[model samples]
Target: MSVTAAKGFTAAGIVAGIKENGNPDLALVVNTGPRRAAAGVFTSNRVKAAPVLWSEQVLKSGRLSAVILNSGGANACTGPKGFQDTHATAEKVADVLGVGAGEVAVCSTGLIGVLLPMDKLLPGVETAVGQLSEHGGEKAAIAIKTTDTVHKTSVVTKDGWTVGGMAKGAGMLAPGLATMLVVLTTDADLDSDALDKALRAATKVTFDRVDSDGCMSTNDTVLLLASGASEVTPEYAEFAEAVRAVCDDLGQQLIRDAEGASKDIKVEVINAATEDDAVEVGRSIARNNLLKCAIHGEDPNWGRVLSAIGTTSAAFEPDRLNVAINGVWVCKNGGVGEDRDKVDMRYREVHIVADLAAGSETATIWTNDLTADYVHENSAYSS
Candidate 1:
């Protein structure tokens, strides 16, 4: 289960005739709640999709009653007509669900610079509304896939409340929220302020650190909605932890299912001058294409790691820098340490630890090895 794992939520997915391939392409999630509080995070990119722009305004109210999502077309770069289409879709959903148009959030993903078929999508919204069920979470997740081989969902239940969500992304994964559409729902009785704080905190360390291909999508959006059906307000720390766990799990799933990826790389930067420095160093290492290619070839290339770190503005001494690959110290004192061959690379998960030796701060960034299949898939993506 995904969003519907939480109480007071009903969801559905159905074929919307938007994708020429006849794949499921429309999803709807509604909050039948006594209280509706919501928060959201979107891509930092200046060029945002129409849905993102519309949803940003909707979230300003810090309340939501439903979310409508679709795949097969991003509805981006299509100008005023695209935004009109998005607003019209939301109106259709509101008309069917008998909710305020301002209370509806929309999300779209897939190829950019294309217009969605409103003829098919609007009717699909009605169909999805009719099929809404408590168990439609998985189907909704499947309807949002582009090139993903599998759908992703995560759930965390506390003593009396739960936080659950679904995500879709297999390519164009990078920072600025990892090029994905994620909707998280909870039954805990929390206000918009609490939900906003926890969501920002959770996403800062989770989605903000995943860099698969160093490409961000314009449609990236992550939403958290509260229904207050449980009427159980746990401690802020506990709720925040549950939210972080779910986001972390979903972030890892995105890396595991990265397009054409073979090895999941964990780049840990330790002993940095500050947390910002640590994060900068970790992202630098994770986004280095040379390091990614080398990882795919099972090579413990510490030099590539050092080179990537040197490109960052972080505080570090080349002579004091140390690097470890899969628990084997491959570089120490900025020179070769143990034999590189001793570092085993037989597993699908590779760990790279970089010690800045400047302070006591640390950060980890998740990424995946680059592969030829990635090029082939992306080259023919629009064809």
Candidate 2:
């Protein structure tokens, strides 16, 4: 479906002079309200970007009229100037929209330690405001990307409500939201409490489970805004489910498009003592570069998976572990299975299953295969 038909929100993207590439670097999303509640989740990294800190504070009100974002400068570790830049950006957007500064949230991504060029950014916000349209979702998605090859977006409809989202991330991705930037828009009527609860739960399973390169970022942010534009207030349960599905799709896409990545890997942990245990075990495997590299090489290395899981606190007997790759049983009773050669790593997708043999719980994590290209790309990233 078209992003306009799906999101029912207005957006704009413009080149704000933040990037040297001259590509679009500033974006704006506004809900032409019937004002709806909003929810946000920022990076878990203690060293957060200035925008992240500002948005987190504003999100407490559960009311958002607009979001302003920029790329090419993270505005992290820039000290007081960073906060001032964020404040100035939001104030500008609020002034343009005739709303309070606190009513607008801000986000930024790109190079770290560099100050935001207010001279370039201030005027860019004005240009973005002029370009707002329902068709701007795709442009906004592309504007947020740093090393990503493509923009990620997803939409789903259920009952009478719609949930739509755009995401961007390529490197410095790991759990606790994956060094990603996301904006979710919905027309369902929901309160701040319900939106916050739903966003947190959905993120725990989706964005929180993806681990690409295992490095977190200072600029990750996921903002969800409900415009109540649909005027359809479905049950909270149904609305949350639709939101989860959108996040799940976007999270998988982020893994698929990770920088220098050739394969998207799925790690599943089953029969853990509890859901938390299952998630922990799955995440451990997802974050292991050695295991990811082994999978990239098409080596059904059950030992690597087992070793990674061992680092987790999940209660499991190593001797009872069972491993499978691409539906081919590669290990049984903690030993190598007979069909290890059947698993292929040459494809763009890879799957690994680990049976904890402890209980009836399961969790899955999405990741990217490690390659020498990944090393080369990151090694020279700043050069």
lDDT of 2 by residue, 253-366 (tens): 888888778888888889989999998898899888888888788788889998998899999988899999989878888887867777777788888999999999999988
Candidates' RMSD to native: 1.6, 2.1
TM-score of each: 0.98, 0.96
Model 1 bad stretches (over 4 Å): 171-178
lDDT of each: 0.92, 0.84
In Å, residue 268's CA in model 1 sits off its true spot by 0.5
Model 1 over residues 16-62: C-alpha lDDT tens digits?
99999999999999998978999999988889999999999999999
> Candidate 2, after superposition: displacement of residue 34 in Å?
0.6
Which numbered prediction scores highest in TM-score against the true structure?
Answer: 1
